[model samples]
Target: MNLIELSPEGNFESWEISRLKELRAEEFSKELGQSMLYENDEFRLWDITLKHKERLTFRRVVNDFSYTCITDGFGVIHLGNGKIQFGQFKKGDICSFNMKENEELILDVENTGLGILKFIVTELKLK
Candidate 1:
């Protein structure tokens, strides 16, 4: 939502993403035009942001892993020990994939809009 605008100079940590103190989906829906639709015991919500050249390392904590749409900017993601693929992603793109504990992702932001990433995970850890 428009609530947590991240800093442009700081890297991101999935654990640092903030959760609504009151868990008010209604307010988010009203402001952002959509809100958290579903959450169960198996998944926890995550919302994060990254500036250009700022990367975050994340590990899958759930079996059914999924990423929500990117709300702002574009980026290229690099897996652990892999080259930064020429591929790029922009806003409104959603993806799902399998990841291992040893795998890591480094998001290379290519825009100044700030990369907004949201997803659901149960037990993610910083690697």
Candidate 2:
């Protein structure tokens, strides 16, 4: 299932973590990828690739953003507020979010599937 899980989120049943620590958004780099593909006046493009069980942390301060899935995989999101969620994505799947003023999304994502998870994130700079 291709889904952009948000609003009322849920945790994964197979998620076995000895302890869930509070992840500080400010402490982590806000960059979505290790390398930025492109950036201009109105948009920023990022390529993200995560190996199985690998995790990446980032803060979503921009209000308008979209991500296209390049590989099929399962993911787990660990929010800074102690919330957890499971995301199922497939190749060519696209998810976008447009939040209101003063809204932000901060979380860490982990690839839980057996294969790699890859995606391209595009952040729109609204004037």
Candidate 3:
């Protein structure tokens, strides 16, 4: 998976950590995406779109989920704890993660590419 993982034990520079802490102080979304396109008893669907130089912070409660890239683009993944990463993805690329109980993932995403970066996230709610 192209997903980025962030932990205090991970290799992250001092400055990057500081910046992540700063971002954590700002507002962040509890939802997985910029917009909740749909939701029901079984799952929730979301849409996220980012123009060049756009950034968004999100607190993701870990669950089994998958997402599809809607456009080819590059971007920075910033964890709540301040780890920064640059990633490139194709238009059709898709990624998914399965979380056991008590696991959580949270981060900020910034679209650094010129092209619009978009994704559709499907989260399967636990029983």
Candidate 4:
């Protein structure tokens, strides 16, 4: 199962949290430039890193919800058709998000930015 830690700098929307926990296990993966995963059909976590020094925008059009936590560096989140959430971290901020199906997430990062980490958890499971 994928597990992640979210920053304590900001508050997350309650509906976002609910949606995140409802995401299915098979809907996540690790691909080029993106780190996504699911655990025992209970939890899902991933990180999307921007290795470049330039600002870039990330777009995902899936129902399974996703959120971003600033593990390192700085960034802003823009919600196009869905809700996007965030928290700030300096060098050691630990942030995480739960996943839900069919939720869109967009991330904009500055500099050689570190990616966001997310986690989705299912009931009847232990962390």
Candidate 5:
């Protein structure tokens, strides 16, 4: 997987961004075990928690231009019909997506030990 550290200037380096793209491409049908984070215009932060190092599977459907991130944990996110993107998420990580349609954001926790925080976007923005 391609790894990139957030830049001090808040802009990702060219090489690092390219590497992130590669990682996103290779994330077909793979289960991820780590903390997840995302943000949009209305909210500044959203944290998805994983318990006992559990796994979350991300699947992309090329024909539909959509993807799904399924966690046996807890979280909420806007779904859409566009090129799905993902990367290795850690504490303080953030990403944004454009919502083309009204989508359902579902949160499920398989174990009581897991917890998460979700945010919704009222305005369209990416940073």
Candidate 6:
């Protein structure tokens, strides 16, 4: 896989994939310890809590678009090609990425009690 470092110090090394594997759709929340905190026609929100050193394999389904906010602790997202740091995300301090359908990703949690909120778009309309 390709790796890119956007930071001058190159802190991206910690986010690299070591032994991650793609999770099947059936695994879903069961593997991530997640629960649907809220949902609506426009989007769905999920809340997840992870223990120290825990990880969740993520795969984007077709037409999926989502945002994640880390409420507690620190984490990382591995996009197979590269990675990004994930910590407390304030309003207006967001980052995003685009990917093809069924792309597999990895979420690594550091520090116990890692809390995350995921907002997923569900209103895709084709012209």
The best candidate by lDDT is: 3
lDDT of 4 at 37: 52
TM-score of each candidate structure, all chains considered together: 0.41, 0.78, 0.80, 0.34, 0.23, 0.44
Looking at candidate 6, what is the lDDT of residue 7?
Answer: 32
Clashes of each: 0, 0, 0, 21, 0, 0
Per-residue C-alpha lDDT of model 5 across residues 1-127, encoded as one tens digit per residue: 1123223322334323543464346544311223324434433222334454342334322211112223322332111222222233233333333434443222121222244322221222232
Error of 6 at 88 (Å): 6.6
Taken over the whole model, the C-alpha lDDT of each candidate is 0.37, 0.73, 0.76, 0.37, 0.30, 0.41
Q: For model 2, how does the per-residue alpha-carbon lDDT over 1-127 read when each residue is reduced to its tens digit?
A: 4445443444433334432432431566667665789999998898889999998865645448888999999998766555676899889999888868878777678899999999999888783
User: By summed lDDT, which 10 consecutive residues of candidate 3 come out lowest?
Assistant: 1-10
lDDT of 1 by residue, 3-109 (tens): 22233223233222232121222122111112344455655455445556554442213243556555545554432222333324445556655656565333322
**Model 1 regions lying over 4 Å from their true place:** 1-40, 58-62, 98-127
lDDT (Cα, tens digit) per residue for candidate 6, span 1-127: 1123333332444533433323222343222225666656655555555556665555333333455444434454444344454454443333444545555433433432344433222312111
Q: Arrange candidates by TM-score, descending.
A: 3, 2, 6, 1, 4, 5
Model 5 residue runs over 4 Å out of place are 1-47, 55-86, 102-127
Q: Look at candidate 4 and tell me the lDDT of residue 83.
A: 35
Query: What's the lDDT of the predicted structure labeled candidate 2?
Result: 0.73
Error of 6 at 2 (Å): 20
Candidate 6's displacement at residue 107, Å, is 6.2
Error of 4 at 2 (Å): 25
lDDT of 3 by residue, 1-127 (tens): 2534433435456545555566556655668888999999989999989999987666665778888999998888866555666778788888888888988777667898998999999988993
